[model samples]
Target: MSLSAITLLGAAGEAPTLTVVGEGVVLVPADVVYVSITATVQDENLTVASSESSEALNRTIEALIEAGVDEGAFTAGRGRSVSTIQTASRVCNNSTCVVVSDGAVNLVREEVTIRFDAREEALINRSFEVARSEGAEAGIAGYALVDRRAAIAEAREKAIQNAEAEAGALASAAGLKLGERLEIFERSSPLIREPSYAFDPLGMRMTDLFDLSWPVAVDPFETASSAEPGMMEVISQVFVTYRVSP
Candidate 1:
């Protein structure tokens, strides 16, 4: 809801505890721009289909490089599949009809996609232009920071401090004093098996993930798509329980 979500619970023999959920978020510019090219081709012969795809892919890469994109900035892939196509039609002669022989042929379909980091402003715009001129689909895949873990580390500290501040303020309003933390929990990403940062209440916090600088791109791509890295979020949240003196 708000920046903090608070809850209160008590038991017969234990001190009343206040639990609050705090959140932190940071917006950072994109460090890298991902440019992509895709080509879809079909032919009766698999060899021909693969060749067609390769030709289109090569053309796009060459154009990108010629536009000042280095070869080291490229990533590419290709895939192939086969399916049957119907060609023959039924023929009838005075109520006598015969099934056509060899009415189907194998059609090979191939797909190729080339990706690259168009880190420079000049190369970034040229990437989309090259893909478009070469008869290939042109688009930007995404933008991201180089150091995501460092961003998360900063957010984690803010969330913890925010939780503590909210608890203290709410405790004071209720005529009680804030005490030591009883339990600490981190709300991490479900998709991530290993979190970027961890908490240790034993006076030993993870130091390797923090105190890092993420330099912004020298020339940020003006949001042609309106969905640039400026919208990306490096966020952290926590649920903290604290004892409240009666």
Candidate 2:
């Protein structure tokens, strides 16, 4: 879709006006993936809940580090606490109702985010496994392209070309000649959306540490040995404006 506006130049006394607006879009594959690891603990004791949640998060972070992920690639988010309530209701013979409350239990949750190149599929999968085994939940949050600026620039050039073509067609239809460029305005910025992936362990059992035949391995840089990686989309949009003469 496209739109345009006309503006008179030179102190509103000019005979010629400028007509502008053109848009272009492009799609590219995402090159990076963002993974989110969450740890949650619920108990009557706030301290216990918080401690357990923190430990789970720490374990996940350590696993990622062991998998060859740089320490800088992970960020810890703010911790959150919520009250879980339990309620009981009783009905009397006269259709009257009485309600009793058992008070509230505190639940604490913490999260860590990991950013890495999508090519590190094995490492990403290993991180998920480690987080889950540590009693945390892990999933892919979204995907991103490494060089968004370059993609936007390419899309912008295409948009300008589109605007020129439209201007030429409009000028021809109006029995006028396309003139020199007067103005270029961007209608909107580039739009990109990263797709989310749900975690599915596929019933893979955790290797038993005591089983020497299937000994637990500790490698930080290893990618997923089995699971397939996911993909995301990157979109770029550009708008342009030009002038015409009779």
TM-score of each: 0.60, 0.69
What Cα-based lDDT does every candidate model obtain? 0.62, 0.64
Instruction: List, residue by residue over 1-246, the lDDT tens digit for candidate 1.
Output: 135556676879878899987766665555666666666566667677667877877787788778877777665555566676777656799988876765555555444443344346666777778877987776666655665776677777877888999989889988998999988797454111121233233322133234221111111221122233334556566889999887
Q: In candidate 2, what are the lDDT values of residues 154-181, reduced to their tens digit? A: 7778767877787787767777777788
Query: Candidate 2, residue 3: CA error in Å?
Result: 2.6
Among all windows of 10 consecutive residues in model 2, the one with the lowest summed lDDT is 208-217
Candidate 2 achieves a global lDDT of: 0.64
What C-alpha lDDT, on a 0 to 100 scale, does residue 31 get in candidate 2? 81
TM-score of 1: 0.60
Which residue pairs collide in model 1, if any?
none
Candidate 1: minimum summed lDDT over ten consecutive residues — where?
213-222
For every candidate, C-alpha RMSD to the true structure in Å: 11.2, 14.9
